[model samples]
Target: MTTSTQIQRLAIVTGASTGIGRATAVRLAADGFHVLAGVRKRSDGDRIASSRIEPIILDVTNDEHIAALVERVAQDPAGRPLSVLVNNAGVAVNAPVEVLSLDDWRFQFDVSVFGQIALIRALLPTLLSTRGRVLNVTSVGGRVAMANFGAYSAAKFAMEAVSDSLRREVEPFGVAVVKITPGAVSTNLTESGLAAAARVTDTMTPEQRRRYAELSRAFIAQAEGFARDGVSPEHAAAVISKAVNARRPKTRYTIGRDGAMFTFMPRIVSDRLLDAMLRSQNKSLAQEKR
Candidate 1:
């Protein structure tokens, strides 16, 4: 028989196969919560190091998987209640709107917006039972849009609205909704985005391809350069852990120096000037090729 003492606080972290999701799950387990680490691949589950973590196969984009996860967490022994849900599973679709396909746009919102909201809805009962918190691991793009990131950033921006709305609604019931926006974190996201962008380029007409050339080149360079300069996933993970344990968590946590700058600077800076700066970045890439 399971005793009350044997039960532990639970945290469900999506995209636990890599980067911030993986780091957060590891850190939470270290901090004494039994983490439900959601990974899409069996091989990834094999890589988690903590005994307190149960690596569950979960793909946020799959409806059946989301339902099954809800059912699985609901079966936790009588005394164990879920304390947190980290919506971290996401894909980046990086391309200018002119070059972006309809399918790519749908996939971006499907994973980061619809799928995440569905999981949260399914898990809300379990969360309310424990008066738990919701942590959305978003990107710096969520706050300030940039060239070639419209699709991905749109989804994150939508998520920011969702986070705010949910935060207000859930707070009266003692549930907190927190958003963690990190900038240029060392992760597989950029590589994945670039891969998707390559496929988009392959499908483009000659004119569209030429039109997007400068933006694509600049995007690739920026992503690669940021990978070298970005903070580690551990930095984001630590903020998440702190948010999880705080008596009164803030509405958002900007995880790095770059994150804080990108998220807040847009509010004070003029839109026209920002657009000029971003356009200049693309021009600089074209100049490099000349």
Candidate 2:
């Protein structure tokens, strides 16, 4: 396999600005892949350009950026086939269903689900030819909705559904689909998601605000704790590297201690028991009003 990589070992990683995506891109490059690291900001691209990675502007939600990426891959000097596509670009929303603005919900799905589908669609020809893999970087929330995380979980759940269907459909073609579910990955995503949720809180009516006050406060603290407890993004990147190189990778890889525990527990417990366990973990909601 090491010798075969010389044929066309190109890989594209979206959301390479920071976190797991950046780490994965760097790791793949170290493993001898011609990595195209995608970022939405010029500063991000500049930061990663120092490495062997070739950074490109890729806002996954934008059709134009997707098109540009396709063309860039198509024009590979070696005309090399894309060996892998890492759909790591995503946004998060923290509002409850009642007040989750329609736009917020749409925005969550826009990047995580719809944009990924579009990327796969445009890149399918290349992927099929190369018999490459598609790795969707999802969350533990995809398997089990977390408290106060309906908007983000909903998007990830949908991503899981499509990935399942896609795997079956493309397996015959030698194209693989794998989901990377990281639990509380120590990334800026937690901060950004909580901040976005705060904005949603501001837009609420006084009555609505009061209704959400307690749980929302708990939720914010919960997100912070999750971020603090998370393992380094490099650990998650290592798991992703394994997935890309495995002869027959598992359907999913869950990173972090919490990620592994959550994934395992869900399989053995009944749904009702799982709900009880989840609620037990939501002790933040039990804190007395301050």
Candidate 3:
């Protein structure tokens, strides 16, 4: 028979204002878990809060907020271990390596890599005590890089590495670290990232722009297309919920068909073949424009 402890779980999800994070927060609450929906803004938090889900203002980049969250988790009356920590907060900046500014690159890293690490470190004590699970929401771009997504891919690659190392480090303590690589989901990230990309592109010298025009357009179009064809955030959230609740979850979970097929399949194929295939796809998109 399942005990009360087994039925009641506490889940903390970062970036819970919208998209995957928001969806996951709602789903976890519905699954009988008390959810701490972390958002950077109070308004965003307010939008996510409900009877089951409680909104908490958390900017992963802010040390003070992270510390507060740790304290709050430590004070839970049930003394039930934190069942899940879903690190779904990330930012994307799309631009060719040459045109991508240091600030833009840093911005992506700050949110996706450094911010995530900061939050994990701050909550390590509580997580260790509880033997909870940590889920890092990476991206397929981490495994396979596209031309214009260099900045974003670099951050995700670092996140993937961090997640893998953390998984090994905490295993002895009964804590599980899972890397969730999502391909494409309908979210504001693409539109916002594309705008940032455009700003970076505008700052490029005429010569640089001329040299990279086609690649730039192709990248923007790809981002837009992905946003359009992306799966629902709810679908992705369900996968995350499973990862948290499963008796024996895998080390890594890939969400979306493209992530499972194209992203994972390239690992088995030759690098040259993969490059050629990507080049062909981009070329086709360019030709369609002309």
Q: Tell me model 2's lDDT, rounded to 2 decimals.
A: 0.86
Please, what are the lDDT tens digits per residue for candidate 3 over residues 187-251? Answer: 88888888888788889999998888788767766877878899889999999988988888899
Worst 10 residues of 3 by lDDT: 1-10
What is candidate 1's lDDT per residue for 1-290, written digit by digit as tens? 22243237778999999999999998888777888999989999999946788999998878899888888887886456798999999999888888788898999999999989999998998888789999998888998899889999999999999999998888899899999999888888878887888888888899987878787788888887667778899988999988988879998899889899988889888999989987998788656555
- What's the C-alpha lDDT at position 208 in model 2? 85
Writing each residue's lDDT as its tens digit, candidate 2 over 175-290 gives: 99999999978888888887898899988889888887777767876777768788888988999999998989999998988788777777888989987776775554446324
Say which candidate scores most in lDDT: 1
Model 1's C-alpha root-mean-square deviation from the true structure amounts to 2.9
Query: Candidate 1 or 2, higher lDDT?
Result: 1
Q: Of the pair 1 and 2, which is ahead by TM-score?
A: 1
Once model 1 is optimally superposed onto the true structure by TM-score, how far is the C-alpha of residue 63 displaced, in angstroms? 2.4
Clashing pairs in 3: none
How many residue-pair clashes does candidate 3 contain?
A: 0
